[model samples]
Target: MIETAAREQRSAEPVVRPVRPRKLGKVPFVELADGRLQGVVSSGSDLARVYVSSISAATHGFSCSTNNNRPCGGLSGGSPCKHLRALADEAVLQYGLDRVTRYLRVEAGDDDDLMSRLDGTREAAPAAGVFSRFLRHLAYLELPGSTAPIAEMHWFPAVSAEVR
Candidate 1:
């Protein structure tokens, strides 16, 4: 059923990025939790956790890593790799114009209201079952990385059922 469909989607090859940045697809389903914007993108048959952190003092800007425990090729050595950029583009698209415009006005800083809401969400525990798993998977991004945290002002209405 749902598991089979998700597996099928995961098995599909990752969308090839053009030589230059271009719209690849809609933001792969994402969530704002624990003061981070998190999403899992399939790289070939592997799952990579991609995230933007909201903590101002953190070291890195963004990071991506696969389920197999490999750092994203782009994120290694603190580079702004294509994978990270694609994920950000997707997130902005998902966030929409109104939010992006506001995010821009704030200089993508932590002071934005949207960031505050998401950061505050950390105080409230994530729901049980699916949400917990989704949080766990996304939480992997918090491991040592090159980026600082930034709140995800745009809230995803509901958790994606894709978490297994």
Candidate 2:
């Protein structure tokens, strides 16, 4: 579910820019992690499949592959595929435009969107590490909610609410 609370004013809290959450139907997991905007994105053609996608900050080096490590067929065109686009769109929804563009080190030109400004080259990166972390997050969701904190949750980064 998207955070409706993100719409409320936080004027008293001293926040210069407030976050705006969005409901991501295709992107179940997204994070500004590992110096990139990375997450698990559902396949458009198959319900049982997903792609691990990431766009590196500044350099915007990109990668998209199946959990088993097969490269996406869409990458040969020298442009970002649908999966990578969805990942960026959802990243903006989750992190807000200002924060995401800043993290990606992208400077706006005209009214162009985030994807258009990205200058990236496909780099084959390992899918296992990101997939592994997403799995851990899903596992935590299976636990019963309790007031008492779990010891391991302490190690979770406080940077974003999606992880918690």
Candidate 3:
């Protein structure tokens, strides 16, 4: 694992790489962490609700539910719900297709669709963990912009200090 201090001590020069960005409307939050591709996906039916969906990296086990713990009706045994698919697609955008492919241990040719290649089963997993993480991330966005170091972030490296 990369340590915050170690990362902070690196060279000041910016390292350039191919950039990829995604619209936040569909799947606002996506991540490849905790051994799964998980995120909060907007609900198509209800404007007030968002679904938390996840696909396991090992077995591609799937689950989707509202933040309120209501299961998504679309998650049948044969396939993952649209929210899960959206989450995976957004993950690929956030983390390159190659990274995601390697993380999930999926083998696919360049021309193949990512989801179509996955053979997954409907797994009854809890949504609380994923949803709570999403909420915590949102909380950071609400914090007032400040250069002052936060006490809670003592371990975080201030790489921005190197810019100027």
Tell me, by TM-score, which candidate is best: 3
Q: What TM-score, over all chains together, does every model reach?
A: 0.38, 0.75, 0.77
lDDT of 1: 0.40
Q: Measure candidate 1: CA RMSD.
A: 17.7
- Alpha carbon RMSD to native, model 2: 8.0
How far off is model 3, as Cα RMSD? 6.1
Tens digit of per-residue lDDT, candidate 2, span 61-129: 899999888998888787899999999888877777777888889986436678888888998776888
Query: Residues 1-164, candidate 3, lDDT per residue (tens digit)?
Result: 55444545765334434336779998889877899888899999888999999888999888898999898989755688788888878888777788789989998666777888889888877689998998899999898899976776644434431233
Instruction: Please identify which of the two predictions, 1 or 2, would achieve the higher TM-score against the true structure.
Output: 2
lDDT of each: 0.40, 0.81, 0.81
Q: What stretches of model 2 exceed 4 Å from their correct place?
A: 1-19, 147-164
Order the candidates by TM-score, highest first.
3, 2, 1
Clashes of 1: 11
Model 2 per-residue lDDT at 55: 89
